[model samples]
Target: MSVRTLPLVFINLGGEMLYILDQRLRAFNTSEDNSEKGVWSENDRKRVMNDIVGTLFSKSFMDELLKPQQLYSHRTMKTVLTRLAHTSIMRLNPASMDRLYELMIMAFKHQVFLCPRPKDLLLISYNHIDTIKEFVKDTPVVVNQVNETHRKIIEVYSSLSEGEFQLLRQTLLIFCQDMNIRVSLFLKIKIQNPNGRFAMTTAGPVPHGIDVPGLIRTFDSKGREVRRREFPNGGSYTSPIREGSFELHGDRVIRLGVNMYTADHPEETHTTKTPSVKPNDTPNLLAKEELNLLARLMGSVKAVNMPGAEPGFRINLFNTDQEEDEAGASAGAGESLFGVINIQAMQDEQVATELALIAGQFAEKEEESENQSANKGDELLAMMDDL
Candidate 1:
């Protein structure tokens, strides 16, 4: 017998048959491939997954997605059909047929993609069967929570339709499995109408670490942690406490750096109202009124989550004397900011054991030196005993 052409089967988590239709020919075929003949393995599956990602989320696709609402009626469905030509199974269901149509409509209608707030928080976890939570009354959806005092807002994320959600859930599972940061991460999600949603129906088991958003921490005006300003170092620095928080990374210590603007004299009224300076003129080019406003408005934007930067209350160094360095007119002063790190675990069992050993040594020394006991300083003895 000539090499038997492969017959392919498309199935979902529910064992439902998936088919690709060629309406013109009115023919259906489930072309099984050499996958059953040991050609497809874990690594091969990974390669296929990568190919799906590269093709679907390519830069060109993303750019088109940004303006997805534009009608694509003129463009022939040939391009889309060609991509789906990879699969073949004659027995397709109405769900499968409608699913394909729905996705196409979404792409043509500009509902294919979204840009979520706090960009990095891309995905969230939720029960697959969890029905959308509805409010008691049809109220306006508040996409983000704002803090009036600190002007901080909790990040809002995007939700997906059933089809897009399922696809993403599958793709992300593949993507995260091979990544170094394979730990499951929860994220915020926004819900929109389908192509409702899609996922592995009978395609076997659904992988972990992908879903819609669940219980999230809500923040109010008093909540300050979520609003830490990121400070970019090694560049020209602006003098606005509104300039936000300095970026602290790597193995560097957190230090306080402040500068005063002399030209800005809110304490002394300006004889003539100064015009706004060119942004290039100087970093500290605020008018006296603006300067006073900035100083008053510099309501310490503290970091909510970042360690060592939470006590991050803003200060106007201009009003206070600059703690000059050993070398006058140097870059800036570096004083360590305290209470940023949680070191409770640092005093572990080993630390307690070490302290006990030291105290024992001190007690023995005190006994050996009888005459020295007469000179036992209360402060030193108390310190040793405490240790």
Candidate 2:
């Protein structure tokens, strides 16, 4: 038996027989001795059959492939089909027949190949019970482990008919949503739908949000350590504070980096109503106003979930001039707008363990030093005797 002459089976990824249409036919004009011509003729026939199968698989075979709805290039579809055709055992089934129709219709509409006669096509549109059972055994549908959001989406798709599934899949592709999430919800969606990048970039299995107080403590300890190391002499280099807090409650916008833009006294007095600023200028003015409003709203709260540089909160470096021994030395000088703090956002589980360890060391060391300093010579001698 020749490899070229062997009966070819057309199967989907699930190993279901879509249909058995035509035998590999040779061109009447080609000689068997002309290997190039014979090979060419055989390849051409296989390609046509592949296109027919691809069209049947698409949503509206005709509309999905031919109309503006089709996104893939005709050439791309050919490559996809050629690859799919490599699988063994085409199982006949209601699902397979339905998919074949979609693929064929799409291919025909796209003019990927000349449409074949129904007679020439030899449509084997019967359900292969054995193949169906095997397919069910071998290819069970599974939801991707990372995408929980898609689990809900698939439930909605389960009620849809095959045609509806195809249409919905196409719609998801057009709208630029996660097809994996969509497909996991609906088993009928193709296994080959492009792997979704949105999920890869944005979604993770980590808990949704973070802890506020814990995060602040972490940043504070870290900042203090860094500051102590850097400024062993105390010139007060300002480091970053918590920028703002996005909590389970809601995000709080911080206002810092303020630049005063009040009119000069003479300009204000002469104010012949400065030609009512144009709408084009309104956006910048509005942005400045909003920043100021945010500053006022957040300014003197004893504590917020987190703190850091905000748009309106400028870090001004005003100095105290009291011969280095002023009674209100800290109070006289401008306070660090972000406060004397550095806060890190606390992520979950593993991070919590790390933070706890570091914090424990610092607390323990401080306690040890304080105890040692409090005990004088006799107390130290007594403690040493007990040891």
Candidate 3:
């Protein structure tokens, strides 16, 4: 279990969430039929994007997240993401949230399984970060935050050895193990089989820095190549492409973490749940100290509602209320059991004390920042008057 696994998991899943939300929001705001047009506006969509991205890359939260730590359990991660999603005004009901989570996990699981080499995981994460930067491109503050975090990611993970990357990939595979929900888009593209597993293609360019299969070379005792032989390897392959850029800016050279949802393929968002897709009912025995740390990290997320904010509206993942109801009805027992935590129920005195301290500090920081922004605005207005 690599300590580096949590950042990748959070980032990829967050990227997936942004993709789904962007599609759903676009559908509502720009549908040709006009029936869904009034529900979401361009401003509303921007606000949701800004709020979620800001909170996700918040200095406090990212500072905590980038530290060395064990990967969180699936349930704990789900709960954290649920909170992250609601950091904006957009709301997801229990059923819609469940479906959204299913789509996110399955999509990322496919990406992970199809990754050519373990070290390429960094490329995949770069793909996600690139797209995320695009999402908040208009917001310079958030873009700067993302850029800073990008540098941090490169600084931390770039120095890791290949074996460490391999371990990280294995840890991610374990995290995604047994998630087999069938997605319509993958099935439509023939990339996923009927039973939900992604079909691995044996015919393609091999990973960067790897030679194509079917060649064997014999070396003499003096380390000179004595003979070369070729064998039928059952698969056709080609030379690998140039390695992807690992810097803050360049092509990631892979599409695994890129947004797949588009207006042209709204039907692709549909997911077919199977009986084997049962939720993990076993309780996560996460340590109390870790839970406290998570609570503090998440406590820094800004409140969704503002004093002069517009009225909030819900964003449903399904096309209609009926589908949402059916999904809710079909959800397995114990699926919702661990979706949230009751902080009040924690009996640990230390946890409560730490949470209170974090809350107070966050409140004070927010207030001071608001004051600084207000003063800056006043100064800008005065400068314009002088002009």
Candidate 4:
């Protein structure tokens, strides 16, 4: 009896081949030691493989490949590739080795690993290796590759020693945060997986890591880890303060000297409550200085501060109206800017004094004239009585 051969296939295109990732499934099988429930069997895998082969050879797929989106930056290219890696539509062309190489080079060049895991494959690219080698100048390529598995692998190689592990982690975190923001634009739907592992079943639309409420609870339940130490010059440090300072969450004012503690602390301490401000008081003195900015906009400050004018210097001018019946009072002059501002409005005392003096002189002259007229009228009346 002749033995039937189950065609053994290895699409050896350095990291771009994801659709036919039977090898990853095999690795998972070896590690898990149990077949995932609902997982495709060997026969199903063969069928899917045949479907993939069909699409790769099809003219439609080739058209789409030729009409790739025009992307400006390496970051944008990475986003495009990451989306493609997650998509199930693209059929893997096993025979087109050149095309496969092109895809792999594109993926590796752009740090596509920062994206979510590719389905059915554990992809690693040569570009990542080159990047790692460049980052750790004196390290061997093998060591750089292994370092991904064990991040602290730098300690093992004296030639590749870095200044501090914490610094590297911080740099990596900042880099990832920035890249993630850029990548988020392309992610039409967020795919979540707990622990980045599937226990024989894919959790659809699930987020990676613990849920928000659970994470909050876990943090609340954790014990308070206090860090207190004595520094030189009788200085003391507390974990909460250090944590806040390290995180750069407090006021940014620079203090000059040792008495800086008093300078640095807000009026109210040991509470999250913002200190109550007086109706006009400002917490930031520099903010109060900004009121002077209004002066600049309005023109000279000296014009705003001239001394008040005396009421005598002021004139109460009026409009005369024809007298009607006694039922209603005549309407005084309607408020006008000229009247409100020049006659009635407050002004310098010297200007007011001059105005009052002028009005008094006019009153005296009118009184003298009335007296002269009355004397003339009495003389005329006496002449008439004598006659």
* Predicted structure with the largest lDDT when compared to the true one: 3
Candidates in order, TM-scores: namely 0.17, 0.16, 0.75, 0.18
Worst 10 residues of 3 by lDDT: 245-254
lDDT, candidates in the order shown: 0.23, 0.26, 0.74, 0.26
Total residue pair clashes for candidate 1: 36
Give the TM-score comparing model 4 with the true structure, all chains together.
Answer: 0.18
Model 3 per-residue lDDT at 89:
77
For candidate 3, the TM-score is 0.75
Worst 10 residues of 4 by lDDT: 1-10
lDDT tens per residue, model 1, 1-387: 101000000001000101111111112112343243322333333333233323322333322323312111111122222232222111122223323332222221111121111121121111000111111012112111101101211111143344543443343333222111110000001122222221111221112322222224446689854533343333342332321122222332211111111122322111111132223223222232333433233222222336853221111111122421221222122112212555655668888999999999987774454323212222222222222
Q: Where does model 4 exceed 4 Å of error? A: 1-20, 28-36, 67-69, 72-107, 110-387
Please provide, for model 3 over 1-387, each residue's C-alpha lDDT reduced to its tens digit, 9 standing for 90 to 100: 898888888888988999899888887785334245348877788889988888777766676678776676665677678778877878788798878888999988877876778987877778888999998999999999888888988999989999999999999998888787889887876777888877776677778889999999999999999999999978878777677421111222227677878866678788886556444644333333344544554453334355776545788888898988877875654456447655645478998889899999987885565444333323322222222
Residue by residue across 54-156, what tens digits does model 4's lDDT show? 3222233322222212211222223223223222222222122222223333222222222222210112222222332332344344343334423322222
Off by over 4 Å in 2: 1-17, 21-70, 87-103, 106-153, 156-387
Model 3 misplacement above 4 A: 30-38, 227-229, 244-254, 277-279, 282-310, 332-387
lDDT of 2: 0.26
Q: Which residues of candidate 1, in runs, are more than 4 Å off?
A: 1-35, 71-387
- Collision pairs in model 3: none
Considering lDDT, which of the candidate structures 3 and 4 is the better prediction for this target? 3
Q: What's model 4's overall lDDT?
A: 0.26
> Which model scores highest in TM-score?
3
